[model samples]
Target: MQKVRVLIVDDSALVRKVLTTMLESDPGIEVVGTAADPLIARDKIKLLNPDVLTLDVEMPRMDGLTFLDNLMRLRPMPVVMVSTLTERGADVTLRALELGAVDFFTKPPADLANTFMDHAPEICAKVRLAAGAKPRERAAVSKLDVAPRLSADAVLPLAQTPGTRGGTRIIAIGASTGGTEAIRVVLEAMPPTAPPIVITQHIPAAFSGPFAARMDSCSAMRVMEARDGQPIQAGHAYIAPGSQHLLVMWDGAKHVCRLHDGPPVNRHKPAVDVLFRSMVASVGAATIGVLLTGMGDDGARGLGELKEIGAPTLVQDEASSVVWGMPGAAWKAGAANEMLPLDAIAARLLALAHTPVSAAASRVGT
Candidate 1:
C-alpha cells in the first residue's frame, strides 16, 4: 500500500520538527514536507500534494481558522488541527472541527517533553485515518455559528401537569465528528428536569472541560467532566474526560461514574462502546441509548448489547449526520429501535422519558 503522505504546518520550528519526526516514525506514514505557517503550507500543499495536513491553531501571518476556511472553500482536503491544551484552544478546536477539520489534538505543556513522546502513536494513527477522509461541503457561516435556533417541528409539547413517579430512567449518549453542535442542540432542547445523561464524545483531554462548560452555559442541564466516584443525578450530564474510559457502575442503591486510564478501545480512549457496554450491564432495561452523528463504528456492537438487554436505542439518521459512520453502524446492525433525524431525536427522547412505567415496560417486552 502507498504510504500516507503528511504535511506539517506550524509557526514553531520545534513543533514542525517534532511532528514530522513523530509522524514519519510510523511505517505507514511519510513526511512529505513541513511549512512554517499556513501561507507556506498552501504552497507546499500544491507542490507536495500530501494526503493529509497537520495544522497548528495559531500562526504568525494567518490564523488556522482563516486558513482552514480558505482551504475548504478553494481546495478541500483532509486537515487535522494541533491546538494548545487550554480553554481557548478547546474552543478554537471545536470550531475547527465544525469548519471541516477531520480531527484535532491538544498539544502538551511546553515543559512536558515526554508528552508528545507518549502521544506519537495516536497522532500517527489519526494522520493515517485522515488521509482517506472525504471533506464535506462547507456549511454556510451563519449555520456554523454556535447560537441555538429553535425549530417548531423539533419542539416537544409542554407537559400539562406533573406526572406521578415512574421507575428511574438512565440515558447514555455517544457522539463524535459533528457531535459538539449536535449535542448542543439536543441538550438545549431538553427540560431542566430531564433524566440523568451520560455522554462520551471524541475529544481531547484539555477540551472536555471547556466542552462541558460550553454545554453547561447553553443547556438547562448541569454539565461537567466526569470524575471518578461522582454520583449520577437527574438533570445533570457527565462527559467523559479525555484519555480516560468512563463506565457507569450501579451499586443496587445508586449509580456512580468511574473514570479509568485504560488502553484505547475501538481507537478511542473514552470510546462509546466502553460506556455503552457498562451502561447495558448497569442499567439493563431501564436505559435509553442514543447513537448520534459521528465517524466510525465504535458504538455499534455495544448499542446492540443495549438493545438486546431491552434498552430503547435511537440512532441519528444519515440525513442529519456530519459523518454518519457510528449511527449508520447501529442502524445497519438493527440495534436502533428508531432511526430519526437530528431535529427529531430530542423530541422523541422527551416523549419516551415521559412514557408511563407500565407502557414503557410493555413496549420493551415487545
Candidate 2:
C-alpha cells in the first residue's frame, strides 16, 4: 500500500506539531505539511494535496465548519476534525460531520499528557479509513432540511399498530464510519408508526446525545440516546450511548433498553455485535435486522445469529455505503437476506413489520 499523506491544520502551533509527530510515527503515514489556519490550509490543500486533513474546529479568519462546508462543496475530500471534549465542541463536531467530515477525535486528556500517546493509534486509524471514503457534495444532504416530516399515521397508514402487549416488534440497526448521516437518511423517511427501532452507531460519547437530537430534528421518529432501563416504545428510536453497550431484555412482557459498562467487544464499546446478539434473546423472530455502512466486521457474526432463528436481515449495498466492510462482512457470512440502498431500507423494514404473520410464515414474502 502507498503511504497516506496527511496535512495537519490547527491554529495552535503546539497542536500542529504534536499531531504531525503522532501521525508520522507510523511508517504508513507521511506528514506532507502543516498549516496554522484554513487560509494556509487552503494553499497547502492545493499544493500538497494530502490524502487526509486533520482540522481543528476553532480557527482565525475562517472557522473549521465554514471551511469544511466550502471544502466539501468545491473539492470534496476526506476530513477528520480534532475537537475538545465539551458540549459546545460536540455540537460543532456534529455539524462538521453533516458538512462531510469522515470522523473525529477529541483533544487528549490534560491528565494524560504523559500518556497522550494513547490517541495516536486511533487518529491514524481514522485517517486511513477516511482516505477511502466516498464523500458526496453537501447539497444532497442539505435538501433533507425540506423533506416533509410524516406523522406516525403517515408512515404505514394501512398496517396494524406495532406496539401492543407482548407482541411489540423490534427493528435493530447497527452502523459505523459514515453511519451518522446514513442513519439520519433512513430515520427521516420513516413514519412514527413504524416499529420500535434500536440503533448502535459508532460515535464518541460527547457527540451521541447531540447526534440523536440532530436526528430527531430532521426525522419523523422521536430519536434519543438510550438510557438504561428505558422501555421500548413505538414511534421512537433509541441510539446506544457511545460510552456503553445498549442491550435488549424482556422487562416483563415489554422489551426495554439496557446499557452496560462492559469491556469493549470487537474493539468498540457500543459494538454492533453486542446489540445484535442481545436482540436474539429479547425479540427473537419478531425482529428486522439492518446492518449499514461501516468499516470492519463488528456486526457480521451477531447478524448471522439473528438469521439462524428466522429474522429478515438487510444490508446497505456497497454502491451506497461509505466503506461497506460491516455490511459486506455480514453478507459474506450469510447474515443478510436483502441488500438495498440507503433510501430503500426504511420502506423495506416497514413492509416486514406490517405484513401479517401466521404460524407457518417464516420468511418475509417481499
Candidate 3:
C-alpha cells in the first residue's frame, strides 16, 4: 500500500517541525513538505499534490479559514486543522470544520513539544483518516486503527436495570469526524416541540460550549452543553461536554443528566457508547438512537444493544458520510433499523419520534 502524503502548514517553525515528527512516526504516513503560511501552502499544494494537508488555525500570510474556504470552493480535498486549546481557537476550529475540513486536533497551550509527542497516535490517526475522506460529496475510504481501549463498562456497569416507566420519547445521537456540520443539518430541521435530544460528538473540551452555541443559533430547539442534574426537557437539545461523559440517569421521579469524569472509553472521553448505554438503562425502549458520520466504531456496540432491547436505531449512509467507519460498523453488525442519507435523517427521526414505541418497533426497517 502507498503511504499517505501530507503537507504541513504552520506559522511557527517549531510547530511545523514537531508536527512532521509526530505524523512521520507512523509508517503509513509521510510528510511531503512544510509551509510557513497559507500563501506558501498554495504553492506547495500545486507542486507537491499531497494526499492530505495538516493546517494550522493561525498563520502569517493568510489565515487557515480563509485558505480553507478558497480551497474548498476551487479545489476540494481533505484537510485537518491544528488549533490551540482556547476560546478563540475553539471557535475558529469549529468554523474550519464548517468550511469542509475533515477533522481537527487541539494544540496544548503549554508544553507544546511534549504534549504533541504524547498524542502522536491520535494526530497520525486523524491524518490517515483524512486522507481517505475526500471532502466534497465522497465516501471515505480508510479503515482506522488505534491501541486497545476500554469499553463503556469501564465507566458504567452494563447490567444496570432500566426503569419500566413509560414517558415521552427521547432521541440520542452520536458522531465524530464530520459530525459538527451533519449535526447542525439535523438540528436545524427539527421543530421546537421535538423530543428531547441528547448528543455526544467527539471534540476537545474547550470546543463543546461553542459548538452548542453555534447549534443554538441555527436550530429551532434551544441547544446547550449538558449540566449535571439538569432535567431532560423537550424543545431543547443537550450536548455532552467534551471533558466528561454525559449519562442519563433515573433520578427516581424523572430522568436527569449525569456527568462522569471516568477514564476515556474507546479512546474518547465522552464516548458515544457511554451515552448510548446510559440511555439504555435510563429510558430503555423509549429511546431513538441515531449514529452519524464518524471514524471508528465507538457507538457500534451500544447501538446494537439498543436494537436488541427493541429500540429504533438509524445510521447515516456511507454515500453521505465524511468517514463511514462508525455507521458502517453498526450497519454491518445489523444494528441499524434504517440507513438513510443525511438530508433524509431528520424527517425519519421526526416520524419515529411521534409514533408509539410499539408501533415504531413494528415499523422498523420499513
Provide the TM-score for each candidate, comma-separated.
0.77, 0.89, 0.95
Tens-place lDDT digits, model 1, residues 113-185 = 5467567766776787677656654650111112232211121122232222225787899998778878988
Model 2 collision count: 0
| lDDT by residue (tens digit), candidate 3, 1-366 | 899999999999999988888887788999999999999999999999999999999987788989999999888989999998899999999999988999999888888877667778788889999999959622111233456799999998874565445467899999999999999999999999999999999998999999999999999999999999999999899999997999988888888899999999999989999999998888887899999999999999999888877789999999999999999999999999999999999999999888887776566556
For model 1, give the 10-residue run with minimal summed lDDT: 140-149
Ranking by TM-score: 3, 2, 1
Error of 3 at 72 (Å): 0.4
> Which 10 successive residues of model 3 have the least lDDT summed?
137-146
lDDT computed for candidate 1 = 0.80
Predict model 3's lDDT versus the native. Answer: 0.90
Off by over 4 Å in 1: 1-5, 24-31, 46-51, 73-75, 110-120, 132-166, 229-231, 251-254, 260-264, 318-324, 356-366
- How far residue 82's Cα lies from its native spot in candidate 2, in Å, is 1.1
Tens-digit lDDT string for candidate 2 (18-107): 777777777788989999999999999999989889999999999999999999989999898899888889899988877888888888
> CA shift at 34, candidate 1, in angstroms?
2.8
